[model samples]
Target: MTREASPAQRTRALIIDAAADLLAASASGEFSTREVCDAAGVTAPTLYHHFGDKDGLLREVAADRFSRYLTRKQALETTGDPVEDFRRGWDMHVEFGVANPALYNIMYGRRIEGRTTPADHAHAVLVTMMRDLERAGRLRMPTGTAADMVASAAVGVTLHLIRTRAAADDHLSALVRDAVTAAVISPPTVPGAASVTPQLARAAAQLEAEMPHGSVGTLRASEATLLREWLTQLSVLGRMAGGAPS
Candidate 1:
């Protein structure tokens, strides 16, 4: 059986839920602390006691709502193929962004320094997926670089869709996803004559990914750290050689 929340927990939850409702209903996708307090049937002091400030309240609300969204996202089963999983992940991200514009904006649109959100979990999932692709010899770039490219493009397209309130057919999320995949994933090569550069990049990326699994072979922790740093540089060398930033 589920345990009941304490009175304090209950009150905090009430405040967060009220703020989320206000944020969702507001034209600007924001709400004042006074508004949230009033909506929650609490005074400013009570709200501040629980959340410290308006920003804290909003951050909590965003984290709560994003966590719920992630719960649903995590429910989707993986298909074993990393590429297909990434396609589904991209689709889910765009769909969630479009469906929950206010929350999406709060979760991803705001840029704050030194503050992490529940959204970081989503990015972590992407990085792990990229690592899987690297291990499979299908990645064409460093895992971090590929994650950045895919995330930037996906978020940019989703934000455009949100701003324009584009119709289903007009949304170019799939096209953008496909373009990113083509740019970062190696196409299946024939039996012979595969390019060496992508092979090198993939090997470097795979090694970097494996480093986190702990000391490789007989390497000490310090040695593994240095090796990872070198692999990171090597992973991006091919792109640098081709005039892209390392």
Candidate 2:
């Protein structure tokens, strides 16, 4: 059964919707609190009560709208192959930016100190995918590093596409995606010629992923902490060695 939103929830939604409408119609991507309050049919104090201030209100509006894109990303069905799933994620990111230029600009362009954004949630999802690759011995660097590389490159490509209005240039996105992917992911290992550095890194990553789950067996807390330090060092060495083909 579906439950109706409470009155406060409805009011908050009203303010957010009003702000989004104004932002979309805005030429400078800026809207005054007065404008939002008028559009929402709420008093200034009421607006402040709900969202702290103007920046807070804008952040909420961007997060609320960007959540739709994040929903689709979270709902994406993964293939057995993590690399293919990663590629699909990249494509979806670009498509979302191209389809919603105004929302995309505000979502990615603005930065608020000490505040988390929907984009951070998306990066978390990417990090999880990179972990899958690490477990499969396909990742060449630490999972966080690989995820950061992919996120940075994907955003750059998406923004370029949005700024130039070159949504038709699909090849450019694919090229950048593949380039970043190749840099961070290792080729499949042959029968007996597996690269030692990647193998060590993969083993370390798998252990690191499992450690937090109390999967370290009989190791004491102190012992586990020391082991994690060692694993981190190995992972760094693997990254420094680069992603040579196996």
Candidate 3:
């Protein structure tokens, strides 16, 4: 058998795992340096040497996890129908929220914790999607502010899914999709405009390949599948609302 690692390597491994747990357990409060040291069974000097400082370590973890999440989100396909995309997007929101509850809470309400870093990439993606829908003439509103509403509602729906933890039924995704559909003001599609596009599968395939390294790739595959199933269920929402793929 191979020899065991040295003490230094062991310490680093311990810190990383502890940090992950701490991150998962993290709420709207800041974890003091002393608290981290106590939790990790390491000294402050060791943490400082390994990660510079507490804030530095937290930032590092945030950057890493945020990158991973966006990388996964970027891999999602629009499925050719703007309405369907929104439905799928809502599902993605909930799954992402449920899968990474800690990160979701952090990003959603970091201000409460006084961690006020602007997640530029995330805002950019939201803006891009909103603008794209507007260009497609999807918003029923006279103005182009519907995207903001959609983003807010999406986040709300995500929080609802996280907080409401209904019975462990198989159709929870369906429930979320329908609920989200009822919430959004959908696009107007002249008859037959909502048909499936040939570009969808290809686009989805391209998205999956973007995050090949780390567990991000496998995780995204699950997210995509969950999103698709959610879309199918939310079709009821589409019929009830004035949109496609509801």
TM-score of each model, paired residue for residue: 0.73, 0.73, 0.53
Candidate 3 lDDT score relative to the true structure: 0.59
Which residue pairs does candidate 1 place in steric collision?
none
Local accuracy of candidate 1 as per-residue lDDT tens digits, 126-184: 79888988988778679999988888998888889989998433547777787676666
What lDDT would candidate 2 get against the real structure?
0.79
By TM-score, is 1 or 3 better?
Answer: 1
After superposing candidate 1, which stretches have Cα over 4 Å from the reference? 113-115, 188-246
Q: Report the C-alpha lDDT of model 2 over 142-227, residue by residue, as the tens digit.
A: 99899899989988998899788787347899888876766677665444343347887878877776776865778765566667
| Model 1 CA lDDT for position 10 | 94
Better of 2 and 3 by lDDT: 2
State the lDDT at 226 in candidate 1. 59
On a 0 to 100 scale, what is the lDDT of residue 49 in model 1? 97
Clashing pairs in 3: 234-246, 238-246
As for candidate 2, its clashing pairs are none
Q: Give the 10-residue window scoring lowest on summed lDDT in candidate 1.
A: 187-196
**CA lDDT, candidate 2, residue 215:** 57
User: Residue 44: error of model 3 in Å?
Assistant: 3.2
| Cα deviation of 36, candidate 2, in Å | 1.7
